[model samples]
Target: MTTILKPLALAATMTLAFAAPALAQDAQPQAPSQAPAEDKTPVTPEAWAVHLQVTDILQHYPAFHSAFQGPNSFRPQATTGNTVDATLYAGVKPWAGGEIWGNLEMYQGYAPNNTLGAAGYVNGDGAKVGRSHPYARIARLFIRQTFDLGGEADDQEADLNALGRRRTKDRVVLTAGKLNATDVFDTNKYAHDPRQDFLNWSLITAGSFDYAADAWGYTYGAAAEWYRGDWAWRAGVFDLSIVPNNAVLTSDFSQFQVIGEAERRFTLGGRPGAVRLAGFVTRGGMGRYDDATALALATGKPADAALVRHYRSRPGAYLNVEQEVADGVGLFGRLGWADGTYEAYEYTDIDRTAQAGVSVSGERWGRKGDTVAAAVVVNDLSSAGERYLNAGGLGILIGDGRLPHPGAERILETYYSLGFAKGMTFSLDNQLIQNPAYNRDRGPVDVVSLRLHLER
Candidate 1:
């Protein structure tokens, strides 16, 4: 506990240091003559905007029972990890009905076991790659255009990548360039956004919907959406990594993925709800589990999927639903499945997954800016995938050197977020994982986390 608290204390100090200026500015008293008169004229839409955000997460887990350990197994010892990131979001109206945006970000830190071992990994902010020192990158640079199709107009508020303006509810929107696939697909308002909501990978995204992305979860892609009365349709294509889970992406677009989705919006008992069905197919150089295991046996060695690579296609689909049960309470869930015969391409090693959760605001408790949420996820491996692991095969995030007893991975997570200041929040999260890495012989670990976030 002391080890965990030290870093959190340091992070809290840093946050206060960064926010002191803004807090002081708000406290300054203004002269009577400096107060400007209120304008009665209508406001004009913003031509350009800029936003900034910073997030820090510290996580810790205690040692658990482990009959045996392997190279890819989560260590059976108490440990702690921390990750921090700062981002700048800039956007401009380049033309009527068109906008351009870019995100510059710097990140540092690591996840437990450097993001290995569990299929439903604990931290959504934890990337596959990590460094002791902060590294900068152009996280996103994209263009968006909308064509109004005649419908009631709605006011859009100024946001990270949005300009304060009005747009028709019925429209066709097109976007292209570098961004995270989740920005345009498989999104759920209650469970998405690790910076503000749930921090589990499986809960943030469909565990089996292996979207195209590099190590940092960003890629080049193009997507189009058509929204009408109560329905929307979406389609997109994205470039895949040069190799499965590699940091480099395929620049030539030889290996890629295509995705499609349909969503329905409806009012149920005076409450709003949405359902989405999404599917994806990837064409890339991948390996089959059985083939990899076969080759390993022929060579009298441990299974290695990379030794049996071939050009093939993998397909997957998922269902997502979200409903507002009350003024400040919402429910969300997802079910997903993928082609388990082939090795996973980009996401974690989940072949089948089911998740459900609830989120509630603190309005009822007289703390409108606070929030509390809880979720559970069950992740499984197909027969072929299980056999491959039994043969000593390694996967994107899980492998126990050998699998004598395989069980479905189960995760239960809960969190409470307190908004103490404008645009600033602090959260406490807890996760209980059973049968980690699908190894019944291994553990039921407990993890705790602290998060601080600031946005402007």
Candidate 2:
């Protein structure tokens, strides 16, 4: 499916369509008794609502073009991979001041998983790479609703307006679902290998949304979020019991989990620049009976009978800044720190790490519309304590004292996309992996990548 556009003229018209007067909202008083008031109120229609669209994407990267993705291949290691996915995504104002959002996604094909252990130790049995379920990787679903808790209907009539910091838009979003919660730092770097981010790390795309995550794996809970002024916060209590295929994976004792998060967004300069300071935390143990770690630490009883109780959780603090040097030249930077742990198959402790990176993105060539982006991200785990990598199923320790010093890996990517065209883009990315945790003695692995993308 090669789809081309009619150049800048068509996009100019589309942009105008969104700039209509109806795009602006005006205060209107409610009328008394139209026909007859019912239990459910009919939503008022608006033209701006139609600006929304359904989103979908699918692609592949010949990451490791040499050998089988598995370590068993006597020839060499192959980084090549592909991912097929689609999602019915939408975000629009169905009502005058309220928004509606939802998405259904499908993840299929071949990818790498650190926990599954394909790197060196476990020898790369990655994943079966096909149609799987939520617990494994099929789908997930959740929704949210928001409104003003303060009873004020419109800001024009707001008494707090004179304070310079009156919250014009207020909402409370509730999500009853599960989404990937990968890492505290950069996702574009440590993301799952496949599609645009082929041959990458795991922490990056942890918060990614899935359609059916797996039967027992997805979080079955509800989250409530509040957006006021430039600050937003979310907290939720969920069913922690991971969806298990058999009885062994099920919870033997405790049965739930809880999570909380907050972020503050603000503009730095008078021009086009912004900054975000945020923090997130999640807690509760795996509801499994045979708590592996607890059993390991226990003295007398049979470790199996002791049941490991994971008291681990994850919490992170992050700062993001973006500034536009010119129309086409922009600067971006992000810094963060994360700690704590989660129960995979067994109970484990999570160490802490601090990471930071910067990038530039915008239109160059003295052209107003042509856009390009270049970014690089680095991770520093030198401060973390002894930890384990499901380094494929074979656990390997690196920085923080446990394993060898598999130096930090750095990633750099560049993208060029013409604004006049729809669903058209080209991207080049490279990964400089130094002393990998699994192959500490093998030096570095340089991965070069190319990508073409389309979206409508």
Candidate 3:
């Protein structure tokens, strides 16, 4: 990974050096009278905007014990791994109420356990990219058109995926092309961004939803949203990968998924809050746990999901809620359920899950720009799923040698972010895992991580 990061660092430095001179040439001191009347208003005309972000995460784990291990079990040896992901976001307003955007991203590295064991996997970003050297891909390429209704307008802030613009309180937005489902559904303000918030997979999104995507979690999809006052409705359709957890997506539309979500915003005790209800249904070729287990029993061999593969529909649902509890403190929770009869196609091996957590800003401690967050997640599989695991069936990321005493996988994650310089921040994260991969015999494990992030 160092081989890849060196050139990227040099590129970043050269970009800054060139940008400084151009910015200096474009700068002009304005007189008091020449200044805009409203300091908060958007001064730049609707045009092109750019965003860049880079993150590096290093994770380490101490050795732990297990009665037995399988082909895909997490290693019980002290190990350390690192990952880096950098993205360039570019957007342009082509016409009234329309904007086109694209993101070119580079990713490298892998998790110490090859991203296995706990249902709420410890490293979200690392889990997305497989074990490999740095490689570039088009993460997002989409166009958005917003139609305004007769209502007051609000100023939109320029952020990672958005450009500074004004839109009416009531509007309709249509987006099409390749992107991520989470960017439009089941969003929680306190725990969605792995780059800045919770680093666990389950904390960022519904662990059981199993949205359609390739190895890196991006898919071809289109979404439509209607926003009115304090309510919003969203729906989308995306293509599924050719096979479960495969690296390549299907070219045809035979395998796909449909997702829908509804959101409501309100104020509780003068504090803002939001609730989102989301669900998804996928049509694809998948295996049934019961069938696989039965086949293994009849043949006196290890369970093989491939032998029971069939085309079917699987559905899942989850509810997300977040609220600002105080000046710099917030709370969030999620409850999710999925069709446990079928093997997990994407995401983790979770049939039922529940998680909740809190995030606090450093203002309380006089740091002002730092944050602290913690969450607890519990995940379980269905009886058939458990039986298949006991029969030595391997799912996407987890399966121990055996499960004589099956138990729910429980995880606790906490992190603290310290901002010591402009455009840079460092975070210390820790995770505790119990009953990893549903094997009670395997003991609890401890994993720690350090992350550094820069944005411009």
Candidate 4:
């Protein structure tokens, strides 16, 4: 994996101190309406809402980390890795109907793995060096147009006077071109920030499997949303749009591909605060780890490896509610679950795993942006009885050595953020991961990380 970052993307990351914000643009899809609204919001100029936004984040992650097994330990290795990331965001939406968004992200002396601290960032000669950090990680550009297609969250029937936001009533809403959606758990993600969410001490970018995190590194895509209220829906087809290098402006998706998702939102909550529930399914370009491995063995390189771009599918559901639980605190939670293989590689390391979790977010101690929360996630796959842990080289095998422990693997987290001056933020986390099938009584791995986030 290349560890160098682009400097242009980095410069862009630093100059957004006074930008404006237009955060409400990302909205959820709703079902059809049952009643004709006595009052309606039209698409006419008089009813259009214009919003603009600018948001940037800079995060530093410096840690003293170690991994060591006894003499019999699979792998006893220790090292320290420190990385600096800067992300930039800017967008404008002249009206509710259309908008444009862009981003740039850069990294500094980025290194891979948690070395015991020998190399901050090693060069070709394996010598640790400074002053070579760069300007561009990657850049992304996109535009989208939305049309009210069908229904409102409260209506189960059709209403002609109502404007559709998702898949509504006869009207077809389409979003064409390139784009990326901010839908992950970490708010500071999308770009590079040490404070952003982590998976096993690695940036969720670990999901990058290989791709680097970018400010606007997201490529473009086109989608269509059709609705009339009750049965209308939304779906889109898009490309990774990622290129080889932005300097040449290469539009090659050599690794480029397509993806899509469909969903239905319904009301099942009857309690006063109950709002709506959504069940969604997705299908598209997905890769596989084993396949990539095989391709590597066959072709001798990743770029040459034939990706298992199967028409993979994933289905999940989510529910959101808001209510006050105490004098100064309000409680809101979202519960979601999804089942599917993200790529062909997923099937080998994991079959059909259940991805489910819940988050509790509420206001904190009489302060703003100052909030506290807790969350737990469970991901489990029915192993065909295969478990293998190849740490230092020796393999610990159990069953067929193909599956995770017989239960769900989990990650639990809690945090408090004082969204205050100089953008001060602090969080501490303890992560425990265990799988009997894989590790076979090794131990429940525990990791603790502290983050201090700042933004100007």
Highest lDDT among the candidates is held by which one? 1
RMSD of each: 8.9, 13.3, 10.2, 13.3
**Candidate 4 regions off by >4 Å?**
1-80, 93-96, 109-132, 148-178, 181-217, 225-232, 240-364, 382-408, 436-438, 441-443, 454-456
Models 1 onward score TM values of 0.90, 0.56, 0.90, 0.50
- Candidate 2, residue 197: the lDDT equals 30
Model 3 C-alpha lDDT per residue in residues 361-398, reported as the tens digit of each score: 77666777788777778888999989999998998878
The positional error of residue 223 in candidate 3, measured at the CA in angstroms, is 0.5
Runs in model 3 with CA error above 4 Å? 1-46, 127-129
In candidate 4 the C-alpha lDDT for residue 19 amounts to: 13
lDDT of 2 by residue, 1-456 (tens): 011113223333432232222223212343666686555333333322211122122222223223122232212254444444454444444444343434455544443232232121111112223343322232334443445556333242211001111223566655555442321122232122233332233222221111111222344456677877666776665544333112122233244444455555555433355555555544444222224324434543322211444454545555555554433334555565555233222211112222222222222233333444434444433222212221111211121112333333333333343344554444454444433343233324444444444444
Single out the weakest 10-residue window by summed lDDT for candidate 4: 118-127
Ranking by TM-score: 1, 3, 2, 4
Clashes of each: 0, 35, 0, 55
Residue 84 CA displacement from its true place in model 1, Å: 0.4
Q: lDDT score, residue 296, model 1?
A: 81
Which tens-of-lDDT digit does each residue in 359-425 have in candidate 1? 7777646788888887778999998888889889989998998898998998878788999999999
Task: Return the clash pairs for model 3, or none.
Answer: none
Off by over 4 Å in 1: 1-44
